[model samples]
Target: MPPASLPSPSRPWPIPKLHLRIDDLHHEGVDIFLNVVNPKEALHEAIMASFQWLYTPETVPRTVLQILLVLRPMDGVAYTTGTQSHKEIHFSLDHIKRSVKRARDEIMGVLVHEVVHCYQYNALDTCPGGLVEGIADFVRLHQGYTPPHWKPTGGGKWDTGYERTAYFLDWIESRYGDGTIKELNEWMKDNQYHRRIFKELTGRPVRKLWKMYCSSLGDPITDGFVLVSKLIVKSYKPLYPPTWKGPDPGFL
Candidate 1:
């Protein structure tokens, strides 16, 4: 279940119509996907994850009316596309086959990531591609579906996307408070992307936040002087690791 602050199943948020298209029924990945997950249930959980992490009942967008999941032989893991009212997620069956060892979790993670794209704001189509992808992965990270290879290490730019920026956003959420990222998302709904929004939310610039995040991770990106002496030889434990309260009843 989501925290008491978030909407519960009884007070369900709106869910778009979900449609699945399997382009190759005989593909081994198709069988793997079906055996590993119930499509309807998994899709429901993915949608709920977006709502739980990125929106409130009153604030959630209603523009997306349908989401079509297309499982086909593709080169990449997955990607999303569609009109304002409908979205299509193209998931790679080849990737599914490769992820057989953790099929259920991987499929759910990708679904959640792509579902986020269906509903997330994009700063009037001006948001940085990195931040856009970062927010999607941010929700995935919070949902506890993170891949084994993901880590919180920080050295590159903050908006490097994927788990890197997701971890940075997670750090911000921990440092500021819950709803910080939700507010960030809401800010992007009408405005163009700007570094100032980070300041508005946390009273610090995004670059500064990035530096602190890197320092916390023992990444030597601090400006000349070491930010944390303890991190010189050892990793500094994060003050607040992002929390995952597990799934609600019937969530999976």
Candidate 2:
């Protein structure tokens, strides 16, 4: 018998009943958003990004059975709400308009971030909010949709969240192993969130990791030593280059 080929990972994850609603068709933001992306495809791509990062094909989440996106005039950016099997993503049309200069990337980035919440295990809600947000953005960063404004500089406690914590995790992924973040997510599946998960993953406490990461970035470390960064390429690049703030899209 010939060696069987490995299963292709490109097999699509189970997508829910996808739906889209535009609160105001006349809104210029809606026009810009439509011009930038088709809703079904955008949502589908976001789903794929989440699945690719957080699960193997065999382990993909089957809980999400519906995803409805509401594009409306709202303060802040976006947010997701729903039961385990169904979720609604509310996007801010005003923010879309503001991001018209790079609407496609911004819209897609936010979608990917929110979608991760739909699927990621949250340590039964015991995970710190910052870690939750960091994982979301980490997925976004891996997807190659990092905003131009994002800087990799480290500061303000390790789990500070958003791009800052995402970058810190990126450093860990590069220095430790390829699936370090994936392992982090999987570890959270059945276990409660604990800071020691960092040590378990990297053999060092997160504080020490953050300290090293800060000093690597030319930022002051609390330990009174400035270790030079090896200048590791910002290659949070995934096994397959593709490609969030949190489950809640409070900030785009």
Best by TM-score: 1
The backbone clash count of each candidate, in order, is 2, 1
List of clashing residue pairs for candidate 1: 1-247, 1-248
Stretches of model 1 off by over 4 angstroms after superposition: 1-12, 222-252
Q: Can you write out model 1's per-residue Cα lDDT over 1-252, one digit (the tens) per residue?
A: 756773355545889898999999999999999999999999999999999899988888878899999999988789899999999999999999999999999999999999999999999987877788889999999998988888787764676578877888888898789999999999999998888999999998886777677767766564445443323332334322122222221100
C-alpha lDDT (0 to 100) for residue 12 of candidate 1: 53
Mark the 10 consecutive residues where model 2 has the least summed lDDT: 235-244
lDDT accuracy of residue 133 in candidate 2: 81
TM-score of 1: 0.86
Among all windows of 10 consecutive residues in model 1, the one with the lowest summed lDDT is: 243-252
lDDT of 2 by residue, 67-107 (tens): 99999998888888999998999999999999999999999
- Top-scoring candidate (lDDT): 1
Candidate 2 Cα misplacement greater than 4 A, ranges:
1-6, 9-12, 223-252
Each candidate: RMSD: 8.1, 5.6
Write out the backbone clash pairs for model 2. Answer: 143-243
> Alpha carbon lDDT of residue 117, candidate 1?
94
